[model samples]
Target: MGDDASLTARKAQLRKECLAARDGVGPLRRAMAGTRLYARLMGLRGRTIAGYLPIGSEANPTHAMRVLARDNRICVPVVTARGAPLRFREWWPDCPLEKGAFGVPVPTEGGWRVPDVLILPMVGFDAGGGRLGYGGGYYDRTLAGMGDALAVGFALEAQRVEAIPQERTDITLPYIITDAGVFGADGTV
Candidate 1:
């Protein structure tokens, strides 16, 4: 009981610290990071992508999502319920969007789709591709069901942490795209 309580407390503390670090980053820098992210992913084609709309200090992946939509299908995650895995809804440039859970925008009405790749926005990430999200466990649950899909985290280098305190249900992303560069299973690319 004591160990479980301590771990939960530690994860909560880390989440607060990570959010602070992300919030501390300047808006211009954050936009620049998004630009770089777009450049890295612009070459992707033909694969269905599950991207996200940035909320608060989350590193934005919309730039890449827009470009990829030219040759690929782009979708955004929808929070259907508290513990349910997120559902992906098709999205495109100028797609009708209404604020969903937590004020994150979602398609007003679109067909649901599963993605071949997931570009996850993170509050903090370690070199090992350990992601610290907003503690909702949405991505974790989503990833669990999509084990074959490649999960790539997106964040600014400022959100980099030495390590992320994790639980058994936590998922480790094998690839992370940062403002600096991409972190892969072997090393930064």
Candidate 2:
């Protein structure tokens, strides 16, 4: 197999393992972890924040979104097309939501904005800030274009792996928040 093909196969295998681990988390543990994740994000400073609604076994940031929305603008990602970068739309707790691409909930209205901070969901990550997403490349493309937005990933501590297969198009996240603690891109926690 070629380099790209090999990397793709490796990623698929890792993704499966990581997702299973996340899915195996009990409901009570997941809830506690979500609370901790929200507490960690409270210290960050950002006027406009983008957060994702939990899908399946992903960690939910709804608690943080509620707190941030009280004093800051909150937005959620909307997948415009199959291969297009995500569009950020203003969202609040009670905003009308409709299922978007991949069955993820997105805001119904169309007031878009650029977020100063973006909280992303991840399947797995490494100490070096390499993130394993759902292989959609949406976050990578969005981060590449966002310039200076603080990209923070949300995941459970069990999702951490020794390393992730990297591609030229991949974008490294500066910070990843987990139930245990926050990990930095430079391998600091």
Q: Pick the candidate with the highest lDDT.
A: 2
> Would you give me the overall lDDT of model 1?
0.86
Query: For model 1, how does the per-residue alpha-carbon lDDT over 1-189 read when each residue is reduced to its tens digit?
Result: 998898778778877888888888887877777777777677788988999988887888887788889999999999999999999999998899999999999999779999998999887888877888878899999999996998988888888888887789999888888777778855567
Which lDDT tens digits does candidate 2 get at residues 1-189? Answer: 598888999999999999999888777766766777677667755588999988998988888898878878899998998777888999988889989889999989858989989999999999989999999999999998998888998888888899999999999998988877788999898
Candidate 1: where are CA atoms >4 Å away?
none
* TM-scores for every predicted model: 0.93, 0.94
Once superposed on the true structure, which residue ranges of model 2 sit more than 4 Å away at CA?
Answer: 43-46
Worst 10 residues of 1 by lDDT: 179-188
Q: Which residue pairs show collisions in model 2? A: none
TM-score of 1: 0.93
Highest TM-score model number: 2
Determine which window of 10 residues in candidate 2 has minimal summed lDDT.
37-46
